[model samples]
Target: MGERRDTQLDALRAVAVSLVLYAHFLAPGGTSFLGHLGVRLFFVLSGFLITRLLLEARDAAAFEAGPALRSFYVRRAIRIFPPYFAVLGLVWFTDLEQSRSSLTWHALYLSNFWYALRNDWTPWVLCHLWSLSIEEQFYVAWPVIMLLAPRKRIEAITIGAIAFSLAYRFYWPITAVPALARDLLPPASMDALACGGLLAVRRARGADVPRWMRRGWPAFAAAFLAVVWS
Candidate 1:
């Protein structure tokens, strides 16, 4: 039910990947902020694409939630787990100290929690996995949210998620919590995903791009830069 691919999205993915490469390889000191921007872009793209697939699956299954949910989970595991485990297997075979030290957390997709609680990126080779952990968290949680919410209320639910994420990010800096926790935790980082989901919902309903969004991207860009650079 989700076989179609968008060339536009492919182009966007290429751009996102290039940005991450630039950040990691070219940016002086490997500016982590730029890498973060790339990861956030990937998150938004994933939310849009995955939500669209789930919507299509639901419709194709005649809203039979069980079959759609099971199919999605199966496809996701087959697609995601093999390559992931292959990497871990290589790490284990080579006896990489950092990976060996934290293999359990990485295998369980809980590396984000490990890094945040430790408040240090000791295993730099595995540092990138925190984002993957966030993505896995999104995959596990988003389908249930999409299927259980009333169709008409889905948009509202997504917006509420975005609001909660933004609020958490704003409030977190004042707390005694580690900065890594605020940035790595799912709750504080959901705004980009929710915004992507909102866009998918609107497009599925055949709604035109809102006038505000069409005109406000510059403003949005400015605001995002301010927050990231602050």
Candidate 2:
């Protein structure tokens, strides 16, 4: 049977997917609030789940960095690679207009950076891959950090990353940098993931969340409405 916690996560995932679908199909115009909220929810959930798994592995009695890292990578590869490559193959075979060079970016999981550099979206077939690239990039760096960082310091590191992401997003446009750099790149959006990681770590440590905070659904609902109506 699946863990009880997974039931809550599955419900959250359903809600996130619904919001994304609603934003895409029903909402008018660019960057709908629901879409952004859904994407953020996905990021947070990804961070939480990945961090929790890594922590569990580290705490295992037979933990060895080499074997553990290899195992993690293998599992991720098995889970993510086949379908991803199949889609890329299909796109390549069918889309004569797509630049051969652009395929390199997608293959390397750097489609987000490629689009950001050009300040244009990839063809519809690949435009949505940017978020996948961001997550893949995160997967590359996060595991190493989690494996090496001291337990007490991990929370601070995650917090610092979140702060940096927020600052980068807020300030990037003001600078002479490219607009898409902040808009599409992982650095400017890492805060959502970091927030999730922070929560996971705290929960793993058995930190007591206040009852008021635990029951703050009204606040979230109000915020959601504010975004939707804004």
Candidate 1 lDDT over 160-200, as tens digits, reads 99889888888888993677898888986698898889989
Q: Which stretches of candidate 2 lie above 4 Å from their native place?
A: 1-5, 96-99, 210-230
* Tens digits of lDDT, candidate 2, 15-42: 9999888887889888678887888888
Q: What's the TM-score of each model vs. the native?
A: 0.94, 0.87
The window of 10 residues in a row where model 2 has the poorest summed lDDT is 221-230
TM-score, candidate 2, is 0.87
- Model 2, residue 75: distance off in Å is 0.5
